[model samples]
Target: MADVEYEPGSEAASNILKDLQEKLQTDTELQERAQELILNIQDIRASVNAAKAGAGTHRRGGDEVQLIAVSKLKPASDILALHAAADGGQVHFGENYIQELWKKHAILPTTISWHFIGGLQTSSISKLARIRNLYAVHSIDSAKKAVTLNRLRPDGFPVVNVFVQVNTSGEDSKSGVEPEVDGGELWDVISTIRKECPKLNLVGLMTIGAIARSQAAKEGEENEDFVALVKVAEGLEGRIEREEGVKVELKLSMGMSDDFESAIGIGAGFVRVGSSIFGARPKKADASIL
Candidate 1:
């Protein structure tokens, strides 16, 4: 794929984003991303939708899998192009950094649901809680962070949906709860969030499988961590019901650009995909928290 030049600060790009943001309510802003990238996104979406349709297990409903465009590091113009894609493109986008996420969110229309898919710093929580259209946070690894988010959530704001990020791979370098038979510390963190944080809606679990585990898995077999996340979700179900007295819908958020298809096959309700759609990112400082 050839690189498409998109100057985010250029007047043309500014006009483009502004025009799209203004026309969001009307149906006039249906222009797709740049041809090559648009086609790429379309192709990826078709493949994912097919996998969702053919899923033999974990079939929940018509709305089974959500394809979250991991828009971090990509230019705003690139994001706008993909958002203008024909098939519900302006829905979900995931960002990894606090500063970058807020910058994009401010420019994009509220119709675009933003997912904070990175580590949440203690200081950043208050600011994030104030964003009116933040749809979900895919990496809540600590009970204290959950509590802070809950308390700082803007008054009258809807409950912010969150997922307990479990370190299913047991990698010391990762920033998530260690996965175990009963979720180990994962259970305690989520349970505390559920009981104490009324402003937060504990929705599901998320995990970034270890690279080695992904490579070691055979073609027919799912990654060990991916399979473990499913079991951890299952184990937490009964306990969640017993403790909360409410049947919460728990979804699994796993997989990335490399293993989303396999993750979807197993039962990933949400997949954070990037390069396959937008092309590779330039090497830069890591944006992920912790």
Candidate 2:
């Protein structure tokens, strides 16, 4: 695949679209699937926006809940199709695998904002930093990784926006700082990032919540994890403004494919949706590319 970056509608992108057209024309199944995905995304976007309107948060200059299409394990063609389906092109897409994201970033139009939404190793900071269009990173778990990313930011780029991941679920296997005020662990992480790393903007908090909590949320049972994240955000509000020396909307990014609407209703500034738009991904063994 070509590694050169292209602007949307440029000659290179046009060539890519030509190839995409050929693929879609030859594969009826893929064409139908792509169309279906586009409709699904549209519906989800409307629902999320509507929820935000009714939630009464946007009235105070709060950020509209952004839809980040999680594109991990899906083909780049799927991303391109979704981008083309929208008028302004899809502004945000999230990827977990570093190598896979890099490959897609190299080929996709630079207009698309790529967000790294996975557990990141400190070693990969330099590589990810080099991505020219990385809009934000959503899974920053520690002060160490945040410092590493700040130190390695690519030259000439503005600050890299980042979210401190809170393991609200309390899963031992999860990657995030514990959201506890008693010990001040979360405070230390956020304060250290803000005071020490000028290259990284401590923009928000994110969490996966517990797997069991997801079912509760689906059944309309209030998710304690989600509630915890909201409380964490509220608690940090004054500290965030004080530390930044300017009023900043410390966003909460705590929704997924299943409960994004619920998340939006609770003032989530961003929601990550994947399978509901792209359909089920193939088995892990099917993942190739980089």
Candidate 3:
């Protein structure tokens, strides 16, 4: 695979597209799926905004909820097809594996904003940082990782946007800090990022709610896991201002395709949708269900 970066529509990109024409031609179905999903996300955002307007208080995340098309294991041709047809907002794609992200980042158009939304390995921090088009990292769990990521940011690029992952599900299998005000783990991590990591922007908080909670959310019930993450974001708001001496409006990244609608209703600023948009992957049983 070529590791050279290419501008959209550049000769190199055109050549790549030429080489992948067969794949792109077959991606019409993928494009339709993505477009439909985009429309659904927009409709949900609009409905949520309207509700917030009526309630006069529910608004918390940003004005819009961003969708990150999780493209792990999917071919780059599929991404380009989706990008060509994407409407309404930026073409932000999420990847779970560092190596896959690295390779795709090398080949994909620079216009596509790549977000790392999986577990972060200390050894791969350098490679992850080397990605010039990295829009954000949604798996930041510790102060140590934050410091290393910040230190290794490519020279002259803008600070990386990052979400402090909080294991709201309280699952030992998840990677995140405890979202407890009393325990101070959440505060400690965010405070560290705010004070210590100059190259990282403390953008928001993310969580992979328990599968049961996600299912429950679809049945018109609040996902306790998402509720916890929102609380964490809320708690951080006052503290970020009072202690950090900066007015930071932390957002929430707590939804997948399964429960993204409710998450948006609850003020989630970012939602990662994969299977719903791309169909199931090669390995459904994989533990990293980002």
* lDDT (Cα) of model 3: 0.77
TM-score of each: 0.84, 0.86, 0.82
Where model 2 places Cα greater than 4 Å from the true spot, the runs are 1-18, 21-29, 57-63, 217-221, 241-247
Error of 3 at 128 (Å): 0.4
Give the range where candidate 3 is weakest over 10 consecutive residues by summed lDDT: 1-10
The reply for model 1, stretches above 4 Å from the true place, is: 1-33, 57-63, 181-184, 285-290
lDDT of each: 0.77, 0.79, 0.77
The digit string of per-residue lDDT tens for model 1 on 1-290 reads 01122222445445656765555434433334355667877777887888787776556323588889888887666676667666656578898887777667655556788899998799998778877789999999989899899999988977888999988887888889877646557777888887899988887999998767777888788898888988888778877778767676679998888888878888889989888877877655753211
Cα lDDT tens digits, model 3, 162-221, are 999999988899999988864566777788898888888989999998878777554556
Candidate 3 TM-score, C-alpha based:
0.82
User: Clashing residue pairs in candidate 1, if any?
Assistant: none
lDDT of 1 at 190: 80
Best by TM-score: 2
**What is the alpha-carbon lDDT for the whole of candidate 1?**
0.77
